[model samples]
Target: MQCSQDIAAPSEVGAYLLEHLPQATLITLDTTGHCPHLSAPLETLAAMETFLAKE
Candidate 1:
């Protein structure tokens, strides 16, 4: 799965992942830069737990 910051991209990156990596998951958070784990730890952990629980 891919975790992307809402502010970091050409947008097509997420689209490409979804298209080319159909088995993968993509998560976008309303944050800046590339350190969502530090900036949004709770949200990031929650997302990770949710994704992992699915498996």
Candidate 2:
């Protein structure tokens, strides 16, 4: 899974990255940059635990 937080999406660099990817799992945190777990540690951990458990 790929996670991103408050990052620019319209840049050519961003578009280029998207072009090379296949099916993706995106976890977009409500909080901005500078560590999403810091803002929502338990929520992030729970999501991660659930995802990991499935694997």
Best by lDDT: 1
Q: What C-alpha lDDT do the candidate models reach, one value each? A: 0.70, 0.55
Model 2 TM-score relative to the real fold: 0.49
Q: Summarize candidate 2's per-residue lDDT along 34-55 as a digit string, tens digits.
A: 4557767876787788877877
**Residue 16 lDDT, candidate 2, scale 0-100:** 57
Candidate 1 per-residue lDDT, tens place, 1-55, comes to 2345445564578778778985977877665556678888888888889989999
Clashing pairs in 1: none
Residue 44 in model 2: lDDT: 79
Distance from true location, Cα of 23 in model 2, Å: 5.5
Q: Once model 2 is optimally superposed onto the true structure by TM-score, how far is the C-alpha of residue 48 displaced, in angstroms?
A: 0.5
Candidate 1's TM-score: 0.72
